[model samples]
Target: MNILNIDLYSILIAYIGIALILAKIMGSLFEKYRLPAVLGEILTGVFLGSSFISIFSPSLSWFYKDPEFHYPLEHIGHIGILLLLFISGLETDVRTLKKTGKVATISTVMGVITPFILGYIAGILMGYSNQTSMVLGALLTATSIGVTARTMMDLGVLSSDVGTASLSASVMDDFLGIIAIILAIGASSIISLAIVGVNMLLLIVLELMVGMLVIKYIMRAMEKIKTTKAILGMSFGLMLLFAAFSQMTVQAAIEGAFFAGIIIGTTAESKIINDDVKAIAYGFFIPMFFVYIGSLINLQVFTNMKAIILAVVIVIIAIVGKVIGRAVGAKMGGFNWKQSLQMGIGSIPRMEVALVSIMIAIKGGAVKGELADIFLAATMIFVTVTTLITPPLLKWSFKDEIQQNGG
Candidate 1:
């Protein structure tokens, strides 16, 4: 496997080079057609990986199947995932979140409750066991804030009123979704719920009190040491610290990254920090993350009749439950139909969180045999379908607003 006498490691370089070149090419094509560039990046994954290539081009199958080629690519993509959320947080307006906290909380609760109940009922109707039904319900409660955030960013609305509301509500969704998954797995007692509640309380206190104090201190320190490079180093280290703390002990790492961003965002060097971070994240990491997400799809699921049906049903319930539920909550909080629709459309995609719940169920013995396979297939499809639909819906919902604002 020597390429110009460079050994197999040169293969890694070639793989990354090809992926980046194809990603940018496809991303540009999608943008030209007035769609999110990420759609193209994901489609690039679908084309290059097993979904299409492994099946269609078995002769070239070694390219994707060789772990030597794929694993490192996947690892790079995972890092992209972290940076994407970190930047999202950096751009967040905490004050806007504070003003809409009650509404967002209400939206999160309704968002989780409806999908959970509907998914549970769907599972029961399909003759699945009680524990399986619980797992299904729990899986339904997840919201992939990253997916939604990417689409919103593509639309240039990532920090808009609806965007902030969606982000804040999704943070709550991820929290509740994780708790539901743990409960469904039957791994923890009621005490686990109490601990989660306390964690939530602590997160709020930390955000309002500790977060402010720390950011205030960081801002003052930055003013004294005024190099953009040093500020970036400190800010990035802080974001990673928060992300690690959240994942190891409390909330979702994405939420922690967002909070970390907020902290750095408050400082005068925010713009400089943002430009540098964007160069790194958007340039290399985030695109790989989207491609990695796309590559995970097993198109073989399309061959299973039961799995296809299950995917359709779960996806429908997922869409209706999140949209109608969140919309209802938004209306109650004083938003009109238009705004409610925008918020609902923005919050419907479920990715990593839902996958985690489904995986937990499989490992815990709640879903097994043919049922486990079907559930996994269905969940992957559900996430894909939901991810596909969000961008257009958001564009439709926000078209008037964007037009009125004059591009």
Candidate 2:
């Protein structure tokens, strides 16, 4: 194929158009299926990703041979994911989280530890080196709420007692996921650091301390902002500034925004900020990001048995890890066994944040780029299955009826 055939700009335009249209279609379809809107978008992503369609689509195969087409799309997609993480932070009720954060933190610790170790072992046993093992562990440490949130929202369990705890666990998961990525990256860089092992302990303490201080000061100033517009607008502008501040590690920026959101989510101001940012972030960047991801699909990667198997195994590990961790903790927390099991199932889907981290890890050469594709596929599967199943389970548990619809 001639280099001229690979028009970067044209691909970007095409990828965006196709992705957005697909996103809406899939979104509505999933909604009809009683699943989260995210499942549709993600399933679309996997459909776009599979080599069977992408590689042999004859005239459509132009997208695969052209990195110019896929690479930029990936970058744009990542930015979408990053902003989504920031949005996650914005949506969190910081005051309630603070009240729950400690309890959640204790649970998150239990949640991550067993999984981290199991993931590390799984990676090693699966022929992944220490480096990939660490990366594997980092990826497993995440709990993607975007996928789950859509499901929970559609099912009307998003604000219920069971739903909220699952949400809180994921919120804590996001915060911890970012920290885990940073520590994993840190650990991966200095090979000698391995002698002492990954020291996420320090990151855990420091993030909470700094996060608390940042919140105390920022919220005080935020309280004085009379116009709701100014508060939400500047908050995002600032978020992007910090996100780009460390090009190599945007986790800090993402986490910072999340913490910032949690603070406002705790206040009366939450409704104002929530109503506002929805249009701003979702309207532009998020769509761009998801579409770009669609564009990144190379359909040929699926042929690699090693990559395929590793992806499947890691995904299973991710699910088992979270289920065991959350269920056990929930039982201890006095939740019924069924409720605990439901929470475990409810937490399976991955979101934009984890995807972005995979993008960065790929770019930095910290991990294999193909791993990004694997994670995307695995996450999509989890989202689709869990989203549909969760609603029915919740319905049965709650007597299959809503006396007063929250909606």
Clashing pairs in 1: 89-258
Whole-model lDDT values for every prediction: 0.75, 0.61
Model 1 global lDDT (CA atoms, 0 to 1): 0.75
After aligning candidate 1 to the native by TM-score, how far in Å is the CA of 155 from where it should be?
Answer: 14
Q: Which stretches of candidate 1 lie above 4 Å from their native place?
A: 1-6, 56-68, 101-109, 120-194, 200-211, 219-228, 334-380, 383-407
State every prediction's TM-score relative to the real structure.
0.71, 0.73
TM-score of 1: 0.71
Stretch of 10 with least lDDT, candidate 1 = 184-193
How does model 2 fare in lDDT? 0.61
lDDT of 1 by residue, 1-407 (tens): 75567445676687567777899999999768655577688767777666577666677666566788777876777567667767766776666555657768887788888888898889889887666877888898978876678777877888887788888887667657866775566523346546755775577468656767778777668667856588788887888788677756653455567667767777666777789999998989887777766666567767989888888999999999989888888888767888888888877888767765665466457777778768877887788789878888888888886786676
Clashes of each: 1, 3
lDDT of 2 by residue, 325-384 (tens): 877777777677777776666665555545555555655566756666665554444434
